[model samples]
Target: MNRWMRPLVWAALLGTSVAGAQGIELLPGTPRPLDIRAASPCTFVTVMNRGTTPATLEGEWVNGVNSVPVAFDAPAVPMCEAAGTALTPIQPQRARTVRVKVNSAALGTLLGRRSVLEGHLVLRAAQGGPAILTPLAVEKPSLLGRTGVQRLLWPFVLACLFILGVALRVRRALGQEMFAAEWAPEKSWGSNLALITGLITTVGGVTKIAESVTPLVTLTGVVFTLLGLAAPLLYRATLHSLAAHPDRQAGPVWGYLLASLLTLWGAFGGLITLGALLDSLANRLSGTSDDLLGTLVMVLTFLIVLAVIVFSWQRLVQNIDEQLVAAPKRHRQSALL
Candidate 1:
């Protein structure tokens, strides 16, 4: 996908797409719920009752953070010939202009720690059919708000956390296969240094790339991140014990077995999917950028990731014996020198 359009595709993948309501459709898309501030809480929206029977609308504003002392109003007001009528049911094929108002008093009640007093106003027919959910946010500009540090840097920070999670999971999965293969573990300070350095570089590079694509401006991203860290830790700690006692090495055939293939596939596949979900969340904020080519290039790197996955699987399955033999050959060559 083109960088210009890839994010839209990813968004569709990550975002929860609400199906079109069979009996209700909302209108006046301007001043979207999240885009409007508390200073302008009252918005007039038109809601059409598409069903054959007349139906009244019921709605509630669900708070996203601190208990903002307010109620979101969605009342069917008068419209057309005479003037808009007060909160009433709409006849078949008729529409009503709803006075969707949020009490501005919420700004006072919010704890200083929270940045936004956000919520969604869900409108559904009292008779019941399908409902429409409109997400809204009232930003506390002095804090995180829609711009500033939260929009520019927070996404990258979240992305780093997500990368760390995926890397740890990959390490755990590789350790499992290596243990079965009885692959020699290099017990030295070099291994620790290389691991730490690689992690730092990887996170730093990714964060820089995300920073280049700042100001995505979103609240939906919150639903996406976390996990892949807790899961790998929960796995049995067999690799550590195996590394400690190299004398009881398992046969190379163990790594080539069908169970070993399944093990690697399961770990890589599931954790990678989890990683994408978190990554999309990072994108959900920094998802948009002016430089399309850079965005495109960043996405193309997934090809490299897929290459690594394939190589890791092949390293164990296709040439297990060869890999094992080469390791000892290298060890002997080094010892002779």
Candidate 2:
């Protein structure tokens, strides 16, 4: 046989002997129980033997307390003959049972009702050397507590809001005749201003979405901001186009300006709200409260912005109505002249 093959054959023979000699594998056995009456002790059973040559087996269980180690007494059976004065050398195919008795105090320290046990098992070679087959573990007690919230709520809410927003915008866009108009030089100036405001608001909304740590409320803020900014820009463009045509009557420029301002206000408010929400979520996750003052400032900013949007929106609507009513009389006079 080749040199590599010789070691492989020897390892196979050793494995066969070890398997035959194993009366009970410790890992497969039931662990010693915990949480009995205060005075009750615990018991564990295991078996071990050398595979190829004679070897002595010795072990001790270490409880979690600071007490000295306790060793197990040898069993009465002499299944394998002694190799020397040291101890019995376990032969290739022989096996023996080993029992461990743990005192109540040790059991309490090692495996309490609600506490965890942490330790290791070691196996030593007979030629006076280091050990093998060391297994370590941390045992946990049964748990009891709340499991927390369901994961599906946020996604469902977002889907509903998205659908609602899209439907409303689409209905307005398709049914309204307000969007078809020719562009005029004077009206273009107002549209450009609205466009600038819309761009700023869009940037703020994107920032909010990017920082969304809490889904529903933060996402709501982002969407509202984006829509608010977009509405004014759309209105401005449509009005400018209509007024540019000599035959068409454009609404007052001030109404569109006020609308744009409201949209921008609403968007900025939303950005602040979402940013505050994200800061709060971060604090909760990390178990720290460093940004409490910043959060309060953000809340205050949102409130002020909300008030501005509401006021501006009302004013813009009233102005637009007045402008629309007066435009026709002005157009008629111009035609007669």
Candidate 3:
């Protein structure tokens, strides 16, 4: 992905000589300087080309001396670190939305404290002509403001309650006569481990999002982030154990098929999560380098799991009619003869 970035693109966008109107205007009325906020941080200002000529509007976010980071993967917006962000040529009298992202962390660092970004969006014209300087300001609200606590607590609380409900249901199911021989509470080590690790990861994720609170929160996030890396594997093991239980032999083909589907879903989670974790770790360790190892691993895992799901489903379908036919013929054939 880094190879896609050329130094020339950055130079061309950032090195424009002059600054003026440039025949393009911010639509829905020009935004007030201090009215802009970073709580939502992403602003979608419509750029209208009032001139007869088709014009290109490229955005460069800068705080006089420093550049703010723009996330390229933001939905509905196209941004690149090298080329900056640009909109398609708007013909005369046409409008298009231009997304401007303010980096709060960079803003904080610039001001030497937690604060919002007060910057300008440098909109450049074709052939390195004059630029339109649009003022931008960010607003950083308090950490505990407006449903902040609710957002943190509800998802975590609901997830925990759901997990507890599942544990109780499993316990009840195991006590039933049909599943008594198949499920042993003593042998549920894999499920237990997944439960513990998943809960820790969930808690860590919640607190990590609320990281402005304390150093302990950040440390918890780092520790569980590493520990959570094993979740997919443990989850897979639990699903595999449940699906391959001896009692499944007595159930219908649909039941087995459902188990196979569950197994496939579990495998997907395991493979994708593991690959993401590996990619993140590799990126952190390597620093400014990129590789395809994680992608390759994920692709291979997908193919293997897909094949397993397909084969199992096909086998189940083939056996369905055979089982149905044999059932009626067992005692009826003797009676008819």
Candidate 4:
């Protein structure tokens, strides 16, 4: 080989050695699944210059999509250098360890819907040349899964059950005759509220079950239709009862008020559930106008339910206070006579 060719040969051999030795190797000492639970500190290791001439190795983290290189200060080490790559020195036959502290955001981006951390380790020779890359994976602690409306079912059911139990207890304690005669208006209103709430619960439960069972949105449409039908009937019934017998007993007014509040809350929840079902159905079916209309209906239903609940609660409280004040005055007058 010519004198110039000899140097080129050496450079090529050095490059090959650096490339082979400098790539990332998972450290045997590290945990098999990198534990990255919560927003805590983490580290990853790569061996440098395993079988190559001494060279300096530079390190960086890069985004997989945009290929934007993020630089970190190269650790002190003797590693072979390659042309045109970030330069760091690594000693021959020695492993250079790289430590990386991943932030929560970066970990989340790399995880990609998995409750685990994942990314690539890009290792370059100290002499500034192409990087040898390897994939890195870390496990995120499995806490409770993602929370949404779907996860709220148990709590909602428990709330409904608790309210119903209280209402039943109040009714039994008050006695059937006194409940019917003294608090007739409130009783009527409460009964109507219970029926509406129960219907909504059943409809919402069915819709939830359907969503869990199948991904098809058409099923959701059927559920929404049922709720929509139920809503109008409930509204009419409640309105008629409230109009026909506006009076409420002072003693049982608190119980009615509590039931009314629960009913309103349940109605709002049902409206939200129905709206979601409608959106799912509309997305599956054609026609943008229909989807828009469905969404509008959902919003209106939520607002209306909220307003009714607020108004009814205020009325119940007022009646309860009035009766309490009047009862004291009447008793005093009777005692004097």
Evaluated with TM-score, which candidate comes out highest?
Answer: 3
Residues 1-337, candidate 1: write the lDDT tens digits.
3534532343354342232547876764643443233344555667787888988776555543333332223444432122234566777898767665554555544423223454555567778765565555554332223333333243334334443444454443333333333222242221222233334333433454433222221111211111112222222223233354565333323323333323233333322322333333344465432234433433543564455455454443333323333243222211000
Model 4 regions lying over 4 Å from their true place: 1-253, 287-291, 322-337
Candidate 2 residue spans exceeding 4 A from truth: 1-233, 236-269, 272-274, 277-287, 326-337
lDDT of 2 by residue, 109-167 (tens): 44311233434333344354333222233332211100101112332243244334433
TM-score of 1: 0.30
On residues 1-337, what C-alpha lDDT tens digit does candidate 4 reach at each position? 4543532343353343222443333334432333444333334355656545665545433333422233333434422121123325556666655444444454443422223334444556556555554445455421111223332343245335544544454443322211111223234443344345445445545565333223322333333334333433333333212233355322233343343434444444444444444443444453332345545555665576556555554543334333332232222110000
TM-score of each: 0.30, 0.27, 0.33, 0.32
Off by over 4 Å in 1: 1-19, 33-40, 66-85, 105-107, 113-115, 141-337
lDDT of 3 by residue, 1-337 (tens): 1422322334345564333245676654554433122243465566667678888655556755676653321234343222344445668887776555555565544421123455666665453455555556554332211233432343244334433443343343322212111222243322233234334434534554332333333333333333333433332333322254543323333332333333333333333333333333443444411335534444554575456445534443333323332142122111000
Q: TM-score of predicted model 3?
A: 0.33
Model 1 lDDT at residue 116: 43
> How accurate locally is residue 61 in candidate 1, as Cα lDDT from 0 to 100?
53
lDDT on C-alpha atoms for all candidate structures: 0.40, 0.37, 0.40, 0.40
Q: Give the distance in Å from residue 114's predicted Cα in candidate 1 to where it truly belongs.
A: 8.7
Global Cα lDDT for candidate 4: 0.40
Show where candidate 3 strays beyond 4 Å. 1-99, 102-129, 132-250, 318-337
